[model samples]
Target: MNIYKHTILLLFINFLGFKTFSYATFSIIAIDLHTNESGAALGTCYTKQFKIYTTKLNINLADYVVLENNGFGIMNLQSDINDFTPIWLSTAKGILAQDEPYYTAKVISKFLTQPNQDYKHKDRQILLLKKDKYNNITSEIYHGENVTNFKAGKIRLHIDDRFSIATAGNYMTNTHAPEIMEKAFIAAEGNLSDKLIAALNSIGLTNDLGDSRCRTSEGVSANYAFLRTFQNGKIKLDLNITTDEEEQEATSLLKEKYEFLQE
Candidate 1:
């Protein structure tokens, strides 16, 4: 019986991952479904393997519209080196909801890498097989409990569009992984106490976390992506959090405040 259930879950994941967009230089109209009053046209060009998503947004969604164009100029830059390869590295957007249809739609049509005219897209995606609407929902993604620490009086929720990225914030379909870090404190503790979240949300770490390119075991402070633990006697606001060492007190203080672990 357990095996049957597990198989079902895996099959379900097949229904909510990625999408296939046409390889063409075209424009897509993004109408804020929430607010019909505003809309924008995104300029994009797609090749067999690479895609470049672009747009001009004059009005911003007050609280981020799902699948909205985020206006990123260089998810893939058309460099002379990449002239013909069919692979895409795109900006994903959206929140992960375990109960709701929680996946980002494919809205890109550009290429950043080498264009492969003979690139044959044979992989079938059941998630995007629906007529038009995206039906794939997200399963709660926990990297690991040891990877994070939560504070008291504040609930920390961690989510990721691992298999399929969403279009929710910054127009990049893939979310700022560090963003949830900020929201964790804001939603639960009702505070941005310091710029801890803001500093983390900045890019580079977005792809650098865990990736050796961002950090090395030899230098923990030099690397940007980290969720390490700290120790503190007093809960002092981190008015100046520039390095991991500097962030130590603040993280220690937050963990102490929440009492997530006893050490």
Candidate 2:
């Protein structure tokens, strides 16, 4: 096997030995077919206090969302975790190999559902997006059966055929959270980056405590949030923000930074 595949195998083996749990509450991945720009944004109730890793892999919630260069694709892994670096790397490699989003997702699903694995596949939520050979944007979203409640996903194409988006959320305060994001994105007026931020902000407006896990304590959806975009083989925008202050909203902070950059 080549180095990439070999490394993925090693990481998978190590994953079986490490036991860790982390939750990524909500996320979206999209591609602007018009401009060949692709990106991902996410918010999670996870905080520094939850980084109880027994190993040296200091992977954060944002690390679960992998973005490829040249607007090739993106991947988001959320819900229960167990050193998903292997899966993340494999997905990236698959994109580089020109594999279809569905094909890559199927491979990942097969691996996660293997009978010998101790980790339950049903506890995970995954999303994948890519451009096919014909330049058509495609998406695949998997909402594991055992993931937290109030979880759902939506894959939509812009009415104008300008873009394609996939969004999903778990442990949300409302079942319509994903739909809210979808509507906001489709109706938002601006560039791809602006639309993405709007989608996230819509959730915050609908319910700052979108991730119900933090509603009782932080009164916000998440402590960590990020938005990243790529275009023309370059990173056009990248924002990763975190807050420890009580009652502070991470998604709000992300929007603040984005607006600051715009100005």
Candidate 3:
């Protein structure tokens, strides 16, 4: 079905209350911005209690993009184009009702390429990221150590997206939404519920036949996010990273002049 129709349906179910998960909620309509580079992923999800905005901006998406990477970079969730929606609960304890992201540390993943000389040689004394045509982001993944080297996290990311200026509705609160996270998604049998569940399934998520869970598609997907439990730590990738000596200097330079992640 079209997004407009689906959005209206989602809102109805959210406000009217359905016979599924007791705290079933609806996500805001996400509008895919058509712009430079790859593009930007922008959307707004809200309830009377809170509003959430998502800005998966890619630096390359800028008209005259200037990034710390020196060259250009991409930013987005997936490379392809499609629409998706899914609802899941976070298992975090004790902090519902609060409205903010709470990552214990900055998430890190190995990069496809090391940061630019500006970040490395101190040519540009600032923290920067790159984006794609649509403005998603050339996501800078780093090794876990990379984050430990700094000190921040992602759960907080969820908070930032939900309650930051970058998002819609401007929900400026430093609290958590435990009611939204702790509550299980509503996906039993019914008209709207069934339809919503089916839409989620189409996007790679499958209702867990077992108790207390749902499953998502494996491998990289265009418009879906999944959680994977990795047994092996210390990820091994043939990344062309900066040498230890240079990386230290680069880190020091950045600490002096820039902020990578912001609220």
Candidate 4:
């Protein structure tokens, strides 16, 4: 009886120890105009079990609607705290949710800007997107310095009827990968699945933590695709993966199942 009791106690301890940790310096979120779907891709260096990491990704999708073409915002978080300041402001109170390492949504249709607002923070980056009813998209990228002021950067793109992509984290690659992905998406004629594979292939070798690239070994990275169809209002998680190899393997495993996510 004592041995059984001890075994139960050990199991309880192990259960508690099975927490997940995911962190990243960079990520990407995109919206395909033709398909009315969205994707949030992340590259980081934190470690955790696969189950825990995937759970976090699903939870993030549950928090906001990714299909709305109105407007959306993505903010990087340093902790698990629930703060929706950027989202609330960007969406103008349309939706609210906790920030994640990689976040994307359709919130409003314009960049949320405040004149003379000096917001500065070393920990976070804010990327906002808005697509109006008229089909005009406004993109705003900012580096958070603190609570009130943010340093804004200009994003140049001529998006026609093609897909749109956004990226954040680390240095260099945060901005670089998105541009490459955008080109690939256009080259693929707006095929998201093909675009993703092309982008990954173009990304080449991923680096560990402290290094910047499309892939990271020290942190958890994910690529999530949100889909919406005229038949089914919302078909979420069309394509999702935690790593490059996972992307390749899952693509093969789900080949017969998910014909939409294949290259």
Candidate 5:
């Protein structure tokens, strides 16, 4: 991320008071070696009812999922949703510094593990991804000990070792959600965007209330969703969609938007 973008993001975070545990989402990050495109797709059950101190501010939960360096890497920060700007900044710095993904995750873990922090690391779930020039994608996922049930991550590599996919979720209806998403991504045909959308759709198939919290609204999977992809330092596609109304299925709305874009 650049300084200008970073400034805007910081302002947005502060403006919305984004330090809350209302984000219950499932996400997938992947790279397409054939197209040199990297992308992330995610959905959350967040709605107006989930708003905290930022009730008056217009908020987009997608902003919390960091897409840095023009999709060269992505980091999903969930569970506590506290202001981990420092952690994200560190990860961005590590990417810019050309550090390995493992090393960057290690550095961030140090801070997350530190005691007396505003939030406990045991309640946080984070997923990190980095794609090198060779199209080799590295992924790291951390599911805190205290995260709710059905929280887990799965990583899959292409047979040729040219691409990789990573999926993670928390507070889900079942533990098989991540695996289902991975399978959908692999089976789907098209560009990176199509595969990502497929993975997101799988969430709805796995369970009507994929996030479980949506049981209150009887909404399936998510209420807000986003899919973004970049190639060669340029944005290839960016889609952010929310349900027409609360208690609606966001993944369905996302699919509609994605289909329109394809046309």
Candidate 6:
């Protein structure tokens, strides 16, 4: 029903066992007008076991928000750490809608327009992204260079009237999450679901040259959510999985499905 309720449910289920897939590396949230739904996706690359766990959520009901990390992104996950960053805390809020097209921009504007004093991050950069109606994605970046006070700028991107996607991640310059997700989104025929799947697949199958530890014993996993409000006031939730042999083994151990089958 509510975002907090959904978050608590996710935590409950995670403690019940989905905790293994909680180590997120990169994430993407997509709102598709064609389908009148929104989905959140994430991917992790771990060297400890050579497995990448990916989960996609299809939301067609109420508004939703999510937080993802690569285990190294935060000191604790329970403290409302919602941004995609290396050892940073930020909240990502989304207005899941079926007909209202400006909902995504509204949420993003709210996030950036306010001075978030709750975050524990300093001397850090801010990244904002928005996809337009013509399928064009625009972005804005704010530098954290300061001499004294912490102040955020009020710059907005030119978001379109059609469907859109917003993605974020924490990594080095060469392995940045936004770049990877954007590439995958464009390559996947500009479809949110396919883009997320492709992004996760790439994260698992390929190694970032900038990440030397990715080949070591550091673990990686990803969790996601999808939400939307239907015209009939009906809510819909769907689950999809993408994985290889190693990921399959890990998910199987958690008693979770790892296939996007035609059912």
Cα error, candidate 6, residue 123 (Å):
10
lDDT by residue (47-133, candidate 1, tens digit) is 212112111211111111112222211011110111122112112211111112323222222111112421222210001100013
- Backbone atom clashes (below 3 Å) for every candidate: 34, 0, 50, 24, 0, 7
Strongest candidate by TM-score: 5
**lDDT tens digits, residue span 212-258, model 4:** 32234323123322222111123344444343343322222222234
Give the Cα lDDT of each candidate: 0.20, 0.69, 0.18, 0.37, 0.68, 0.35
Count of clashes in candidate 4:
24
TM-score of each: 0.20, 0.79, 0.17, 0.51, 0.80, 0.47
Could you give candidate 3's per-residue lDDT for residues 195-232 as a string of tens digits? 22222222222222111111122121112111111011
The number of the candidate with the highest lDDT is 2
Q: Which lDDT tens digits does candidate 5 get at residues 1-263? A: 45455546656665665433345468888877777677888877664544433334444555556455654566666666655555555545455335344444445545445545435668777777665544456667888888888798898767345558888899887777788888888888877788899989888765553777764566578777788777865667778775656667777789888998779
What ranking emerges by lDDT with the best candidate at the front?
A: 2, 5, 4, 6, 1, 3
Candidate 5, superposed: residue stretches over 4 Å from native: 1-22, 50-58, 70-72, 87-93, 96-120, 159-161
Per-residue lDDT over 1-263 for candidate 2, one digit per residue giving the tens place of the 0 to 100 score:
24354445446535644332356778888888788888888887654444333123444344444446455666677776544445555545455446454544445445445534325568778777766556756667777789988888898865478888889998888778788889988889899899889888777776543788666677887767889888865777778776757678877888899999999
Error in Å for residue 121 of model 6: 6.0
Cα RMSD of all models vs. native, in order, equals: 19.3, 4.9, 23.4, 10.5, 3.8, 10.0
lDDT of model number 3: 0.18
> Tens digits of per-residue lDDT for model 6 on 60-141?
1112223222110101121112332321123332311112335334444344434453242333333344443443434343
Worst 10-residue lDDT window, candidate 3: 163-172
lDDT for model 2: 0.69
Q: Judged by lDDT against the true structure, how good is candidate 5?
A: 0.68
TM-score-based ranking = 5, 2, 4, 6, 1, 3
Query: What is the alpha-carbon lDDT for the whole of candidate 4?
Result: 0.37
Worst 10 residues of 6 by lDDT: 70-79
